[model samples]
Target: MQVDPGDPVEVNIWEAYIRTAVTHAEQDVSLVELERAAFYERCRNAYAVVATGESALYANLIIRKGVVAAG
Candidate 1:
C-alpha cells in the first residue's frame, strides 16, 4: 500500500500508541523497558491479531492495558 509522505507524523503517533500498548500487554511493563526489536514484535503481533477482525479502511485500533495487582 502506498502511504502519503505528508502523513508520516500521524503515522508515527499511531506507531507510538501501538508500541506502548504492546509493551504493556506483552510484558506488563513500561515501553522504556523493552528493546526496539522486542517492542516492535509485540506491536506486530498485536496488529496481526487486530487486523484480522478490523473492518474499516482507515486504521482505527483501541487497546486497553490490563491492570496488574501488587502482591
Candidate 2:
C-alpha cells in the first residue's frame, strides 16, 4: 500500500506513526525468521490506517479483500 501525504513533513509524521504503532504491537511477539515469513505471507489481510485528520479528501480509499475458505 502506498501512502502519499503530499507534504514531506506529513509523510515523515505518517511514517513515524506507523513505525511506532508496529513496534508497540509486536513488543510481545517474537519475530523469528519463520514467523516473519508467515506474517509477510498474510500481508494481504492487512488494512490501511487512514489518517483522515491530516487530509480528508485524498484519504477516501477503501480496500476490500475477499474471504477465502480454509482447506
Candidate 3:
C-alpha cells in the first residue's frame, strides 16, 4: 500500500484535535466545529489536518438558546 506524506502528521493531529474537541465540548458551549486556518496558524505551523484536508474548515460556536432566545 502507498503512504501519504501527510498521513503520519494527520493521524497525530487528529488524535490531538479529538482530545481538544472533547475538552471544548465539556465547556458548557454549543456548536462544535473545527477551525482550520486558525488551528494551522497556531504553534510553529507544524500540523494542520483540518485546514489542509479535503477542504479547510472552521468552527462556529453557537451558544444555543443562551446566545439568543427562541424567536
Best by lDDT: 1
RMSD of each: 8.7, 10.8, 11.7
Instruction: Please identify model 1 stretches exceeding 4 Å from their true place.
Output: 1-10, 26-61, 64-71
TM-score-based ranking: 3, 1, 2
lDDT of 2 by residue, 9-47 (tens): 322344444465568663432222223345445554656
Clashing pairs in 3: none
In candidate 1, the residue pairs with backbone N, CA or C atoms under 3 Å apart (3 or more residues apart, or in different chains) clash, namely: none
Question: Tens digit of lDDT per residue, candidate 1, span 1-71?
Answer: 12333555333444555576766565654333344455456666663544466443324443435777899
Query: What digit string (tens of lDDT, one per residue) describes model 3 on residues 1-71?
Result: 11233545222344455566668664553324334444334433433233333331222222223344478
Best-to-worst ranking by lDDT: 1, 2, 3
Model 3 residue 64 lDDT score: 29
lDDT of each prediction vs. the true structure? 0.48, 0.41, 0.37
